[model samples]
Target: MSHSVVVGIDGSAQSRAAAEWAATEACRSGRRLRLVHVGAAENGTRAQPESAEDCLPPSVLSVRDRIAAALPGLELSCVRMGGSPPYALAAAGEREGLLVLGSRGLGGFTGMLVGSVGLHVAAHALCPVVLVRADPDGGAGAAGDVVVGVDGDRLGDEVLAFAFEQAACRGATLRAVESRALPTGPYVTRAPLDQCEIRDSLAEAELVRLQDALACWHDKFPEVRVETEITAHPAGRALVEASRAASLVVVGRRTPALRAAVHRLGTVAHAVLHHAHSPVAVVPHD
Candidate 1:
């Protein structure tokens, strides 16, 4: 209930990944770690199978032991929050906390919530929501850069604050990927022009803008190594490419008051959530 790293556990591979990621974040934030499960079975009256590894809501009672064995030295607790998983986690994060979940395969649905529960929580949660997808090789957290999608939009500062803090904690480089749309007017002539050269020039100018925005933070967190990628490609596509080697991908959604609708994610954030291979953090800001 207090400040804690809240992870949804279902005994799946992704769930374990989320739990591990949450544990590491908890260690970094100096907060407690709680493994939570929500199920439809009411009052333990439903017929249930007896498997120690079962990740059902009732397993919330036994998962603490197994998970504690895996992540020793960290303070861990387990509980079954009532009601739907997405709504329960959202309510838990309504105050000061972070909600972590495993990314399930949500097929072919754009702007739909990630894996139903994920998109719902990401879209509606009061605090930041992180979606963890373990490495294909079954590796743990990324030992590489912490990549964040930046558009110089309203939430740029808030996104950077979270990304920078995570980078500093992980001792990883911070890569800020910024994509800008180039106006296709007379400037883009039909002549045999140097397309690469024109793109480079535009990208360089955008790079300067990104640098200027991050200037103060660079000074504030001198320890965080910063890198920038400026491209004319779509924001979503560029970020998904960047996520290939990233440990975490940080993106922003408009705050509740500023957001016109709760369900729709800005183009880039929506795209990256579905495509990124690394853990994605949906941060809301004004």
Candidate 2:
């Protein structure tokens, strides 16, 4: 991956917030920052703008200048690309270290926390994509733990690596949550004590699995404090609750086997992106 952060610029307040967040991340990770704007083509088809000026609107330029002033010494560049916004941003993400976008853009409805474009790009981006919202009270940088959903599978290794790196970078605690469904039909017919025993036994096993999944990551980032939670609640609900006090929530998406097939964000990632109180990172894994 290129050591750079790419952010979509649409001149909206949300995109501006994303740009600022991307700049801070770039500074923290020692990566360059790129601002990209996508222009619509005539006849509603995907096409490139005629010139760079068409892509970099006055609002986009204004945001870039502000970021430059606030973050002196940081390398920055601007580009204008033409195509569908989601596909264009996803293409940029494939070539960058990380992709950041506003949770919602100019075309998003007021009530929607994550717009269609944000969801589409997050689902398809080859690299990790972060959705950030504007915070007027400076709450985005608050001291909070980095929360990640753990599945104890190969797909989760990539998610764990990203989460550990983010936690180490921020000097924050890493909270790994693994949610499992409890025993059903047979357990329901059992006595109350038996049901309780089953629940406790399941929790213990899941805790062990969660630890095993995180073993190497802990060794790699010993400086970061690690916390693990095994919940019987649904994965999405558990992560959403954790997100209330988290600075960032990291989740994984399984890439489809067919390159031409459309991909999905999965239920857990979709829930967190829509309801998480802080920024959400969706990492794509095979």
Candidate 3:
């Protein structure tokens, strides 16, 4: 991956908010910041623009100037391209350390919490993708825990690694949560006593799994405070609720199988991205 943080620029308030967040992250990580804008027109269909600078929207220029003024020490660059927005952005993500975008862009419906472009990039990007929304109250970056959903599988190691790094960098608590749903359907026992016993057993097992998943990360980030939670709620709901007090909510996207025709974000990650109260990071894992 390139030693820089890349953000999609479109002139929307949400995109501006994402750019600001990306600037802060680039500063914290000591990486260059790249502002990329993809034109709505198809690559070959449109006439050649007078110049790359002329093609950039005024809002993109404004964002660049603001970041330059606010972060005088930061190395920044801008690029204008033409093609499908999601494809262009995903290609940039393949070579960048991180890619960030607004939850919704200028073309998005006002009611959409996350636009299609954001969802598509999160699903297909080779690197981690962060979706930031404009927080009018400016409370998203306030002191809070970094929460990650733990599935107790090998695929979750990448997610855990990212979460631990984020927590260590911010000197924040790391909350690892494992959520389990109770048994249902005809196979489930109907007796309350039996159900209660089964739930207790399941909870105990889940707690152990969660602890085991966090063991290695704890060793790696000894300075970061760690917390583990096992809940009976659905994973998506549990994560969405956890976002209320978290500065960042992290979820994993399973790598698509070789023969898979379509790529998509997992249900839990999809829900969190749509409803989480804070910025959300979707880390892809195999």
Candidate 4:
């Protein structure tokens, strides 16, 4: 099935960046773009109109106009809804396809890596979501490459395919991070890392295991350039840290309990969504 992209706009500089990215994606994929703007946050009551300036938020309207003008050839439609940004975006994406949002909005703190709305959509959106965060001057396009985190588990196969597809579409490099651990404590108490990884260290046996696991992907997408990194640390922290220079960080959610836990307590995926300097892409492993 084909997929269109729905973008959340608020006229914030960050939102504009997101819209631009979405427009680019839409144009490239020959898909449609839906621009959705949520009304000003209030006490669930409509605001009385005083002047034209106060009637609508400038950032919201400005982004709407800019995206419309920028992608005149693409199928673009705009919406002005009254509610929270995440809710509006989620509803819009329910039919169109993927949901896209900025890393931060006008209400966001300058120091925060990701905004509240981004966190909400990334956690709850029914479809895949992309959180855009790049300098307005266009540093994002040049950030170069998509980095995806994976453990040598059942989930890695699907995640590997998704990451490779995204990278191929974006003309970007793909980096797969297989996270393991190091034996730090005594051997008596040494055990598995809570079913996360079966063993510790990236020894010869571990490399062979990982290579064997990746044989399918290697055969399927032989032309797609990929780099593999075997990390010895916690998965969440390592992936989030790697997102600093990455254009997008891809992570997969597996199992119902794991999904709920990630959404609630911020798993490796959510932590990357909230803390990554770049945008994050969370995909389901099912």
Candidate 5:
């Protein structure tokens, strides 16, 4: 199987982290690493802006060189193009490559927040997009686990399967979480439960259902150590909180079937990408 990991870098510490993460992944997978930094020209217009000819920041190039040097055997290349990071990265992803990027950039102020590039790429990229957050604790160890959330959606299997493979490769534990929460719309019955006790009972039933679903996966991946968690909050929030201990958080993207009635991302997925303490993998629905 052929694979390539393309990372977006802007020369800041945050982007440097993203580059390092991407390079490490490439080395592990024995895939080439394409380190891309969007200069002003390759952005939206596609026209080479005269003034932006030498715009690729020297700091960014230096960072890329250092990372490439650190990883002697890794194949790394840095490109300076004009355009937005998200669009450029997405275009690269369309060729069936993984796109990795930092959640923020050089201006420490904005780096504290998830930038539009990370969000846009996560939502629209064709291949899996890994959005790395700035973590003071540094990167995951060889034994760190890759945790994933599953909800039986189109992309659920993709996320779980990918995480399983990654965990196996890294010799890390594999954990899966399924959330139990009432859907936004009411159940089939129009009759409302008048008593609070009745509502509480229904909630309990839902929790049991979620457990059953998780148990099914446990039976399937018996060799892959699995730990399950249940929470009552929104799916995204629950997953984001859990991400603190995870090396990577994996979630399914919106499938075509659900796109008509809803946007690709719900509130939770958005929150997870913006606030997750670890890197997030947005896997497209298969």
Candidate 6:
């Protein structure tokens, strides 16, 4: 918890919002805050004399200043570096507990706010990467609940661990949503009489599985309240809907080889990353 929360900064509104979110998180976790700026594009020429902050808008600089002054007791510092933004951030986060970033950074093509930088960092970071885009309301940390996506997938435990810990830290309710799809045409040859019954049975079994997975966690954090949901909807759509009211959405990143081959995440996590209103944490697991 004492490890620093590293946030990427660029001259963009979304990046500023991320910094604000990271500041609140650092305050809550009793961790230091590091504001990092990667001056130039990975392949582009470097900017002149001053640091990346000099190239940022005055409003962005003011946001950093305001946060520092407002949270005087919180340990905060800023650093300037140059390289590929994604690589630099991932490297910095190797030792840090979390890497926080804007859903969208500066300098992408039209209609694309979350440029290559955000995507690459999410895909490759050594630690968990959180993407934040604040709303007109009080932003993410005020949403009062943590929503996590759970399935019979490989990395679900890692995601659950993060969700429970975060809920414990915020004293918020933890909502675990499990989205299961029914068996397909060819696979259902033996079960013709009761497709609906089979689906219902599977759903009940999944709920039991989810509960069993969390049993120890429930004991570990007795103060945290947990609510469960089992839906017939697709994972991505289900999580997007849940995210509308969630403070944080937790999902898992696939292993390195799979990530490289599949372009970082599965369909559900990718969809939640783009559509979730809350800050989404991509926790990497084997």
Model 2 TM-score, 2 decimals:
0.88
lDDT (tens digit, per residue) of candidate 5 on 44-138: 34534223324456777687778868987887776765566667778876664688888786544643457767777887776788877656765
The C-alpha lDDT values of all candidates are 0.75, 0.85, 0.83, 0.70, 0.70, 0.78
Compared with the true structure, what per-residue lDDT tens digits does model 4 show for residues 1-286?
Answer: 3467888877777777888888887887788877776775333456332112234566666766776786678888665666566776777776676777888887888678688887777666656678888674853443667888877766455567767777877777788777876555444435645432434432556667777776677677776677777778677788877887677888876535454454432377767776776777766555
Error of 5 at 285 (Å): 0.8
Could you give candidate 2's per-residue lDDT for residues 1-286 as a string of tens digits?
3678999989888898889889988998899999998885323545554235443567888988998899989999877788788988898878886899999899998778899999999988889999998777632544599999988655466788899999999999999988877566355544556767876776788788778768888999999999999888899999989988898999999999899998999999999998888899999887
Q: Quick one: ranking by lDDT, best first?
A: 2, 3, 6, 1, 4, 5
TM-score of 3: 0.87
Q: Which stretches of candidate 6 lie over 4 Å from their true place?
A: 40-60, 109-113, 136-141, 153-155, 182-202, 257-263
The estimated TM-scores of all candidates read: 0.82, 0.88, 0.87, 0.78, 0.76, 0.84
Superior by TM-score: candidate 3 or candidate 6:
3
Off by over 4 Å in 2: 40-55, 136-142, 153-155, 184-198
Better of 1 and 6 by lDDT: 6
1 Cα displacement, candidate 2 (Å): 5.3
Off by over 4 Å in 5: 41-55, 106-112, 137-143, 152-155, 181-223, 257-263
Q: Compute the lDDT for candidate 5.
A: 0.70
Task: Give, for candidate 2, the lowest lDDT window spanning 10 residues.
Answer: 41-50
**In candidate 5, which residue pairs clash?**
39-81, 40-82, 41-82, 42-82, 42-83, 43-82, 43-83
Q: Pick the TM-score winner.
A: 2
Instruction: For residues 1-286, write the lDDT of model 1, one tens digit per residue.
Output: 2488888877666676788788888877788887777664434644232122243454454456766777687888776555767788787766546889887632415433258788778888867899987566644566679998887755357778888988998999999887777666445656676877776666678788889888898898999999987777888998899888889999998775655655557888878888787899998776
Model 3, span 163-235: residue lDDT tens = 9998988889999888766565233655665766776776778778778767877999999999999887899
Error of 4 at 20 (Å): 1.2
Q: Report the lDDT of model 5 for residue 234.
A: 74
